[model samples]
Target: MECFFKDPCFSHEEEYRVVFFQHDIDHNEAKYNQKVLFREKSGIITPYIEVRPLTSSKKLPIQSITIGPKNNVDNAQVGLEFLLIKQGYDSISVERSRIPLRY
Candidate 1:
């Protein structure tokens, strides 16, 4: 999914990164590793991850989130399918290119 900076004036797309989570961790949990480094450089860093829609011909972000499972299939795709099922979808078809991460 796409992520935009919380700052309204920060419109430079290069600063954004697309992250995929392996588990059900929230925004804070995901960035725990980078907390110390960021805090040292920038005082009281309050970074957040905002989920964005996936679109065709979209420019990819430099960074991505990953969890340990070591699966060949993309965990992001698997997460989407699972979410669909939980939301009462009988069957979900994930296109190789445009799988929606959220409803």
Candidate 2:
């Protein structure tokens, strides 16, 4: 799945970041809760996340995305990259290691 902002005014650098996940949890069994971290070029941080209860009767829609803040642009990119890595998209690499906030 691809994600991009609807507005044309956003410059290439101002685009929001997004990550897609194919969850392994069974829809009938339990909800999925994930905490994702966002880091800035200067090392400031933020988090964007989602929590969803599993459903048994039908396939849950991927359209149920939760959009996050657009203020901290760099942090948003870092958060998206972090989420992608956690979800097994291993091709990306973190150039520098920084601890993620837990709250």
Off by over 4 Å in 1: 1-73, 98-103
- Model 1 per-residue lDDT tens digits across residues 1-103: 1243444533332244445453344556564554323223235665444444375534323132222233334875678667766755535445333222332
Candidate 1: worst-modelled 10 consecutive residues by lDDT? 59-68
- Report residue 80 deviation for candidate 1 (angstroms): 0.2
**Best candidate (score: lDDT):** 2
How displaced is residue 18 in candidate 2, in Å? 16
Residue-level lDDT tens digits of model 2 in 49-84 = 654536763333232223343455478667867776
lDDT of each: 0.44, 0.47
Please give the distance, in angstroms, between residue 48's alpha carbon in candidate 2 and its true position after superposition.
15
- Tell me how far the alpha carbon of residue 53 in candidate 1 is from the true structure, in angstroms, after superposition: 18
